[model samples]
Target: METALEKRYIDFDATGFSNEELLTIYKKLVLPRLIEEKMLILLRQGKITKWFSGWGQEGISVGCAYAMNEEEFILPMHRNLGVFTTRNVPLNRLFSQFQGKENGFTKGRDRSFHFGTIEHKLVGMISHLGPQLGIADGIALAAKVKKEQKTTLVFTGDGGASEGDFHEAVNVASVWDLPVIFAIENNQWGLSTPSREQFNCKQFIDKGIGYGIEGIQVNGNNVLDVIRTVRSIREKMLQDSKPVLLELMTFRMRGHEEASGTKYYPEGLQDEWKKQDPVDNYTLFLKEKGILTDALEKEIHDSIKHDIQKNFDLAQNEPLIPAAIETELNDIYAPFTQHVIAPKGDQKEMRFIDAIQDGLKQSMEKYPDLIIMGQDVAEYGGVFKVTEGFVDLFGKDRVRNTPICESAIVGVGLGLSIAGMKAVVEMQFADFVTCGFNQIVNNLAKLHWRWGENADVVVRMPTGANTAAGPFHSQSNEAWFFHTPGLKIVYPSTPEDAKGLLAAAIEDPNPVLFFEHKYLYRSLKAEVSTDYYTTEIGKARTVRQGTDLTIITYGLGVQWAEEYLDQHSEISAEVIDLRTLLPLDTEAVYAAVKKTGKVLVLHEDCMTGGIGGEIAALIAENCFEHLDAPVKRIASLDTPVPFAVPLEQQFLPKVRIDEAVKGILKY
Candidate 1:
């Protein structure tokens, strides 16, 4: 347990680098800082709306930037602008992006330092901090699985260091010995909160000891020290296939943002930190060693000023992002095609779980880049044995068993998807998806519409009520995602639909939530087609047809509706199983409502804010004239699913579907 002061700093040798190389790195360090000052000018001039200054952290950014290969990735935060500048992101494009012009990387979808060019291996950061740390682990995992020698570098603030994602990513990276570096930019403050108030630990470097990874601290303002330490750590990570936690000690010299005044910081703190500024101090250090002369220094400053002025003026005159909503909607998902291999047999009888297993096997075989990950999914065969024997078939590299961190599992899956690999992630129980809800809703769901990027990821949720399993294990949470715009939700009841839809979801070019009914995993069996086929997403299929009444349902609700119709043979009830919930198959729903002239919507989820309400409304708007009776909805009670069998039975609305159907028929 060495204290921060007791720990020895690696003395960097100045003789290792010639004057030219040191000057180049210094030039890279100063450019972004100067540009940031120009941006502050733009902010005051009302040319740019907001700016997060990279004031004191240029040394860490530039040092880390120089350590990586041109092709290696640096998943950067807002303060790491030096990484972008070092990577040679065009001055005009970077300024244009800051000015919200159409020629930028995100095409004005994002104005702040919230965009990244995939080609440059510089993935952008979202407002939420730690999720990107997990994604960086996944990118490193992808490189390892593909046998590509690549290292991923991710930066996080001391505040973000306390986030759960940081722990999950470190745990995963350590367990797998991933090639990555978790660079904690310890700027002494997380927004207005001091580091001491955020964590009980004395230093962030010691936090890595609990996770069994190497930890090192560097003087962030010393560009030479940072560059030497990062270069050595990066080399070790690539050679040994282990992650490192490097803490860069520095301070935020300005407010968190231009608008956030420094009133919260201690008095004279900004001026005190300004004295140790990386750009200025490092320049003075270079001049002392005779590596940088005043004449040469002035030349660099003049050159940067001229360049910044030219780029800033050009950025303001560029075209703005298009105002068309249709274009934005169209870019929400990238187009993808799937190769289907028709089963030789007409159909084969199989359980719902087996059909899912078969679908995963087929997809993995067809697409070599397909990766399956979840808790106990590899050697343990998953909780329900759905992924049994997959590890032996695809090997441990492709079929991985992840820790119980649901958010990182999904976050990593999202990263893999963006890197052009298909990842099928399983949530042990759909009820626990709340742990990863942020990643699903904010990052995975919004990436496409936000930047025209496709997150080709499928999260297989083992959903619906399991008899006596209690609240946490037994929940149908599909309706919650229905309210979100950029997600596709799929719930299948039968073995055939399960196999086809799972395959479709794996190949679909969008982030999809595939809900599998837990009760039906083994109980339901049918002769599913062996051929490679996918039930089209966003389409509804009529399980049973009748003229007197129409019942639209999905998942276990479909089973309940069919059983009720069978018992009352003379009722003439039509049952429509909505395969995909998000793209509501309005045509199929409208046709059924018009023909029967009576409709009932049923689901296993709760009634309030349920998909049933959406369906009921869709019917009222479209088929109002043809309906003989008002469209009604039946769903579970608005309470947590109880553990007791009787209470659970009462909580679910399955039994009441029969009564609703009878009441509808009479109307």
Candidate 2:
């Protein structure tokens, strides 16, 4: 084996670039440095509160961005001002965003450094260190699915390679042969910590070999070398045979953030890095090649200063985010206030499983981009026959079967969603969702909030306590996602509601968690509309009207509540099925509870930390004055669901009409 020093650096003499191209690289590098200096001055003057410098790593970013086609996508990390500028991100909006002005791309939600322009095909910058690799894989995979000849370039720091997301993304991209280039800007520092403290590997590029992919290292300070390396990899990636890793050895001339002073860095390290500055090195190379003269360099610097000032002035004069922007949340999920409704008419009754199948078929027909995949869901019709004959109805391309790796399944689905496909991933059972907990909570549940409305994916899992399945198989984990921020959790009790919610989730532009009750799949039937109809994701349905008590529940619990209401006519119970859980229908719950002056929170999960507790707390804090009696909670016992039929019954909440009537009577 070759020594680490020999392997760490690759001879780039084989790859050639013209003098003009080198000068173009020099200009790109100079622009970002000038922009960064201006932004840094603004930060010190308190005109901008935060900034992350891209001073030393400019050559790598500009070279990589220039190497890719204009149509290609780039997902950048925090330290990527050069990439953004090279991709033509407007400097005005970038500065406005930093100043927390309304004219910013994210409307002040994100800082200046975390800017992106979809029109420019620059996806966006994520402040979180390493996770953008998975997002890039997702976008690249999307390009492959759409048959677009676009490659995705993702940039991260050497320190970010230590993150588990980095490994997960690289592994999946290699396995799926995604059109992506993982570019590591090895600046030798992760914030204040040195790269040696994070990993023992001499070169981060070699780490790609473990995932069955090719790896290359280059002098990141050499713009021509970085561009040549990226362009070479771009050719292979576009063919979709394998993903490539290019480690660009660079340095961070400034501290991690504006607030961070370089107190931890060695005394002369910054000055040493200054000598090897990518912009300075590239400028010298261009001048040496006669492509750029001293006069031309001075002109470029002066032009950038003028451009920066023009944008800064425009941003300062721009108006703040409109007052109506505060009400924009109302427009996020659905246009409920618009009062748009399809003609409500009675239709034939169907089982829950049949409704799911029919809804998927309708959605697929409506949206050609929609895709369905799960274990045994293609030809075998799924474990529960919910997707029976889907492979035949839709082609195999639309209906996919996986290798039973739940984490990979969901992780790939997340990638597909990022690629702009409406991916519907299924967990064989609710309990099996545990296999994808990391993907769900860390990626799916938080994508939209973390990235600001670009994350879109739908995950469906069959849940509820089936008596014979035992503890491992009979679990309701909706509560696990209920507390998560960006996820929209839906639990439908009726066949009609299931079909509508499922269709809506497929159409939604955000990540959604659809939980199907196992016990109700075959047993329950309702008259659902044959014509396409969709219920809002975060809305609740008031099934029955009663003044005595309000029963707030979802999924299987709603069915039990219905039966309870049917058996006891003497005491009327208002039943509200909280179809969606994340943006919990707090308004509906509070309204019903206030009217009835009594509330009962119910769910199939164990009482501890279940969704019911959240609902109970909300009501107690908001509707305490209206309550005629203390809130009641009916949920499964605090234990794993038992295997025995009798024990399972005891474990679940089997509240009948008589039990509800007695509780109301006592109240």
Each candidate: how many clashes?
4, 1
Model 2 alpha-carbon miss at residue 310, Å: 2.5
Clashing pairs in 2: 564-657
Please write out the lDDT profile of model 1 over residues 253-277, one tens digit for every residue: 8778888867898878877677777
Q: Pairs clashing in candidate 1?
A: 341-532, 342-531, 343-530, 343-531
TM-score of 1: 0.96
Candidate closest to the true structure, highest TM-score: 1
lDDT tens readout by residue for model 2, 608-631: 999888898989999999998888
lDDT of every predicted structure (CA atoms) = 0.85, 0.77
* Candidate 2: count of backbone clashes, pairs at least 3 residues apart or interchain: 1
| lDDT score for residue 128 of model 1 | 87
